[model samples]
Target chain A: MYGKGLRALTLATLVALTATFALVVFWAPNDADQGFIQKIFYVHVPVAIVTLVAYVVGGIFAFKQLRTDDRKWDVRSYVVIHIALIFNVVGLLTGAIWAKASWGHWWVWDEPTLVSFLIVFLLYATYQPLRFSIEDPERQARYASVFAVIAGAFVPLNFMAVRMASSLVHPRTFATAEGGLPGEMMFVFLVSLVAMSLLFWLLVKYEITQKNVTWQIRALRRRLLGDDAVAPIGRSAAPTIAPEAAKPLGQRPRVSYENSPEARSRGPEEIAT
Target chain B: MRSREPRPMRPTWVLLRKDLLLERRAPESVPAMVLFSITTFVLFHFGLGRDEVEGSLAAGVLLVTILFAAILGINRLFVSEQAEGGFDAVLLAPIDRTALFLSKAMALFLFLTLVELVAVPAFAILLLGPSPWDALGGLVVVLALVNGALALVGALVSALAIRTRSRDLIVPMIGLPLLVPALIAASRSCAPLLAEGGASWPAAKWLAVLALYDLVFGLLAYAVFDFLLED
Candidate 1:
């Protein structure tokens, strides 16, 4: 079920991303101020936006996990955050490239957007370690959700606080004091944003499907080959989908292997319960 | 037989009283925080190679010292609970889960305030170039708000880390990043008061930022805290 819409999402992401690149390269006009350097903005800002929104979305999923006590939601939340963290790294790197080209520095602390992203990144970077350190799977999921909720509320507030602390010396691309973005630039930016959002959605879908598939395979192995044939999952930072949630493959009628012909040769009481 | 249930806040008060009594008897977290703050001031004096600091430097040193000390206290806030199985006892009681959060936050707030009573004055004697009395009222207001933020974040982080392995490593790593905005607001607000020429009142905006941070996190920690208490 997780993979049902994944193909269409992947196609949409492919088309949108290709269109975004084509438009940015050939269609969008150069910025009057920064010229070619501002081109990086298309990739940087959109990725940043997606990363922040994805984090909040993860929080929403975490909230659902708590409300419903569903292991699947935890799996969804974890994947979303894990992918968003990758997107966050992309945003930071792109921002740095843009900064180096524009300001001649690899980083600029004066920019509240960049600085806020860094703080948010640092906070979330601990999520996995926090998850890994707890031994109980249920507690790990519960605690991770608690963390997600808190951190989700924090993202916007942290942005606001960082923005306030900075005296607005850094130039804002979207709403410059000069005025809002020009018409064509706005269009291009909007397109890029949509493309990035689609890509983020595609990645999340792919990751969730992968996790589900792996889990389903494991469940299938357990059901067909017997419990001894399957390995214990052991300690992990990733949230697990309960075998019950894995469905038909995992639900094949339990075979009493002990009653089978091979086991009959060995006798009933000889088998370990 | 019918039994009457206590008021919702009764458990909070009971837990608060217990924490206060424990601190009163042992005198552990507060004194340790106070000692750490003073020691950090000495280290800052030598590290910065400045006999006296003023303005932003003064604010930075003072707040950073207090923050690190607060982290030290946060690491221990839930230690007794973990060790003595206070969590199970609380879970068995017919009280709201948030009562434990409220009590723990309040206890941390009180401890932080007590540490400041000595630490802030010590900063004045040891490293502050300006007369703190000039901005005493404003400084108190700003520090109180900062303490509110720290206490809220500290209690939450402590609870989160309490059951984890290597909790000592976890508290600061998680707590510090979460606390940056509060520190930003606090240091900015206190910079004016700590200026060398003369102390002055903090800006309205910084105080507003601090208040907003407190409100948001306070509500957030409140809402999600019950989930953490679940077995």
Candidate 2:
């Protein structure tokens, strides 16, 4: 079931992204002024938008983790944050390149383009240490989840605060010729938005797959080696294997931890399977 | 059989009294705040040079100095609590979570305001010259609003800092940017007041913005305090 869903998502993303790129390059009208360089906007703006969406999705998953106490949501939140960081980095690079071409400077400190990206980068960068610092899984998830919500709230507020600063550093809003945009450019922009969202979804799915596989391998190892070798997983543990699978080749699986020296020292309660 | 019940308001008062009594005995926070404000004023007076008119700049300088000092004090407020392991006790108290937040914020606000009352007059006499009583009123309003906003936001950041490796660094990282609007509003409002002039539209607008900020973040801090205080 999961394999089929993955395949369908992959096919849809490939087709959508190809169409979007083609439309951006050929069909959309060039700036009556910026010429070829304006093409960067199609990529830069959509990616920035999707990056914000990814962070918000991460925040939502974080909230879910707190409410449901589910390890799955914690993993999902981590994957979304990872994808958001990647997209944010790409957005920053594309923005800097675009700024150099148009503004005649390699970096503009006051530009909303530069400042907002910096804030988002700093916010996500703090999440990793926050996750690792706590020893317990449930505690780590809870604290990180709260931090995510607070950081998510600050994102829009920071953008607004910077916008209100009394300086003519960056333009308030994007300008397209003819007041808004020509119809073709609008179509291209929408297509690009959809394409980027799909790409992010696929990336998140891949990362989550890798994470769950690693988790399952660890659990399997613990099962085979007996409870003595592996410390008990906390409240965030993956579900136990079904009873039919517990027999392990009809040899009466040696799950006992009583005889192991390490388990004996720690006490029986710590080793019970 | 009688059922045991929680004391509703007493825990909050106990926490508030504990902070106040500590201030009365040691008096470290208020004195340090005053000394810091004075030193900051002197530095700015010398740094900006006498050619710079002290009137408008004086208000901004005072506001910035007071906030910087208050941040120092607020950062230290939790230190003693943590050292004595009193924070967990407070968390384990029977009071509503919001009351704990409010009590801490209120105590800090009162202490900072007392320091400001002394510093503002000394600032006006030495640097900006004497002003009309109306300026004092405006200054009071500005300081109250600004200090409340700071305390509200600072409480949450302080809570976050406790869990982090670098508690000191994280407080400012989360705070300075958030404080910008309040800083601007306080400075603008006080500038006109120092001249004994009526509040201008721009000053009023800035004050309105400050009020809006306080309302939004005050509610936010209340809502999130539980999450932050969670074990």
Candidate 3:
């Protein structure tokens, strides 16, 4: 079920991303002030936007996890956050590169946006460890959901506070002497945004489907060859979806170990002996 | 239904009283935090190689010291509960689960205040270039606001980390970043008060930021705490 739309989504992401690159290179006008250097904005800003939005979406999934006590939602939240953290690294690296090209420095403390993102990056870097340290799977999911919710709320508020504290030493990305992004640049920016968002969604869906598939395979092996056929999951921070929960109840294997051919051949007496 | 149900505040007060009484009897967390704060001051004195620091430097040193000291207190906030089966005991009680969060945050707030009482004066004497008297009033307000931010974050982070294998490592890693906005606002507000010319009132904006931060985190911590308490 999780994989139902994954292929189409991935195809769409690839198409849109390719189109975005085309638009950025050929259509978007160079900034009057920064010239070719500002082109990085098309990639950097969209990734940053998608990263932040992914975090909030992860929080929403976490909220659902808490409300329903469903392990699947926890799995979804974990995947979303895990991917978003990767996007965060991409965003930071791209931002640093852009800063160095434009401002002659790899970093600038005066840019509130950059600084706030760095703080957010540092905060979320602990999420995996937080999940890993709790031995109980249920407790790990619950606590992580709580953390996601809190950190989600913290994002916008932190941005506001940091921005308010630091004045505009760094130029505003969208606004300029021209009174805002030009129509061409804005179009390219919107296209890039859609592409990045699609990519983020595709990754999340792909991960959830992969995890569900994993659990279902294990459940099948357990059903066919008996419980000992499957290895136990070791300590992990990632949430594990119960096999039955990942699929419709009707689709589950009808023959369990007790009712299998192996069990019939062995018989109760042979096992007892 | 049970014939008797305790009032909500009753549980909060009971827990608060228990923590306070425990601190009074043993006096562990507060003393350690105070000592840590004063020692940080001494280290800053030598590290900066300046007999005195004022303005933003003074604010940064003072707030950073108090912030780290508060982290020390945060690490210990849940030790007793975790070690002595207090969490299970509370789970068995009929009272609201948020009471645990409330009492613990209040306990930490008090501990931070106690540390500041000695540490702030000690800061003025040791490294602060400006006279302490002029800045005392404004400094108090700034510290009080800073303390609230620390307390709320401390309580939440402590609960989050307490059951983890590496509780100590997890606290500062998570807590410090969550706290940076508050630190920025507080230090900025305190800078003018610590300026060499004389102490003056902190800007209204930084105070507002601190207040907003406290309010946001306070509600966030309260709402999210019950999940942490699930058995």
Query: What is the Cα root-mean-square deviation between model 3 and the actual structure?
Result: 6.7
Q: Give each model's whole-structure lDDT.
A: 0.89, 0.71, 0.87
Model 2 Cα shift for residue A142 (angstroms): 2.0
User: For candidate 3, lDDT tens digit of each residue in B134-193?
Assistant: 888898899999999999999999999999899999999999999999999999999999
lDDT of 3 by residue, A26-121 (tens): 888887778888899998889999888888888898998888786767887899999999999999988898889888999987787678789999
The DockQ values of the predictions, listed in order, are 0.79, 0.29, 0.82
Best-performing candidate as measured by lDDT: 1
Question: What ranges in model 2 sit over 4 Å off?
Answer: A1-4, A106-114, A166-179, A226-273, B1-10, B40-67, B118-135, B178-205
- Each candidate's TM vs. the true structure? 0.93, 0.78, 0.93
* TM-score between candidate 1 and the true structure: 0.93
Model 2 docking tier (incorrect/acceptable/medium/high):
acceptable
* lDDT tens digits by residue: candidate 2, A27-124: 88887767888888888889999988788788888788767665567777777887888899999999998889888887786676567777768767
The TM-scores of chain A alone, one per candidate, are: 0.89, 0.78, 0.88
Mind giving the per-residue lDDT tens digits that candidate 1 earns over B88-148?
9999988888999999999999999999999999999999998989989999899999999
Query: In model 1, where do residues sit more than 4 Å from their true spots?
Result: A249-273, B1-6
lDDT measured at residue A49 in model 3 versus the true structure, 0 to 100: 91
